[model samples]
Target: MAKLIFVNLPVADIAASTAFYEQIGATKNAMFSDATTSCMVFSDTIHFMLLSHERFRTFTSKAIVDARGMTEVLTCLSEDSRDEIDARIATAIAAGGREDTDAAQDYGFMYGRRLEDLDGHSIDLMWMDVEAAAKAMQPPAN
Candidate 1:
């Protein structure tokens, strides 16, 4: 069976976060969604669980840090091309997210942008040419 990943995030507002994910092309899995929890499906194997502060607290004893002030997790998604990366960032910005243009990284074979969602969770959008990246990583012969 294929492995699947579900990222759980503590969100300030479930409705706003759900709309943000939906605007960026993720579909809501109604089977797992309710007033305090939303299942946002990015792909067949990738999913995000947006949980309210109270709901998230039930999963752990540690206090939930405010994502707006602290950097917790940096989630990244791969894009098909450099253009696609920029496009995705643009879409995210249009949906009330903000792109950290100063954090943009660009190499000849790779490009990436750091985007912050409404609740200040960071999401990185990246594109890379596998062949070029592999060549760049190879050590020179003696």
Candidate 2:
């Protein structure tokens, strides 16, 4: 089987968190889901495992950080285009997530935006056009 990535997150509300993810383009993978956990599939190889706080404790002894107060990680996903990234940000906000206060990043060849989910998990969305990036590196006419 191909290598797969499962991003595990501690969530206060499984239902709400699952809904939030679905709103932003994910499907529930029932094979790995239960009352206290949800396996949200972003694509063939990318998945998110949202576990209730109590359930998440089983995996670690360390206290779970309150994401709202601290940022332990910044999870990013690539989009096909800038428009797709923007649409997802809008969808996320409408579903109760908030946009990060950081200013938008535009490197001419790449663009990105960030947001915080209901559980305060930082999610960064970005798009990069490889051809454009290569072209941009060439010296301009003198």
Candidate 3:
């Protein structure tokens, strides 16, 4: 079986979060979705488990920190191109998400933009020109 990664996030409103993810192109996997939880599939290998605060509490005894107050984890995903990154960010904002306070970054071969979901989870979208990036990192001949 192929290895898969599931990133679990605690959301205040399960339905709204699920819809937000869906609006941004993620497909809701009904196989694991219910009133308190949703399975948002980003790709074949990446899946997001959006769980309500109550459902999330069952998994851990620690208190859930509000994401809006501080940074916990910045989830970043690589994209095919800069346009793709921009499109996703625009979609997120249109669906009620907010752009990151910092400006988008351009590092010659890499470009990145960030957005926050309705629940304030930081989502970063990045794009890199693989060949250009590899060449840029090579040491110059003496």
Q: TM-scores, in order shown?
A: 0.95, 0.93, 0.96
Q: Show pairs that collide, candidate 2.
A: none
Query: Global CA lDDT of candidate 2, please?
Result: 0.95
**Candidate 3: which pairs clash?**
none
Which is superior by lDDT, 2 or 3? Answer: 2
- For residues 21-130, what per-residue lDDT tens digits would candidate 3 score against the true structure? 99998999999999999999999999999999999999999988788888889889989999999999999999999999989999979999999999899999999999
- Please name the candidate that would achieve the greatest lDDT relative to the true structure: 2
Per-residue lDDT over 27-129 for candidate 1, one digit per residue giving the tens place of the 0 to 100 score = 9999999999999999999999999999999999998877778889889888899888888888999999998645689998999888888888888888999
Q: Rate the local accuracy (lDDT) of all candidates.
A: 0.90, 0.95, 0.93
Return model 2's CA RMSD, one decimal. 2.0
Q: How does candidate 2 fare on TM-score?
A: 0.93
Question: How does model 3 fare in lDDT?
Answer: 0.93
Question: Cα lDDT for residue 63, model 3?
Answer: 88
- For model 3, what is the alpha-carbon lDDT of residue 40? 99
Better of 1 and 3 by lDDT: 3
10: Cα error in model 1, Å: 0.7
Error of 1 at 122 (Å): 0.5
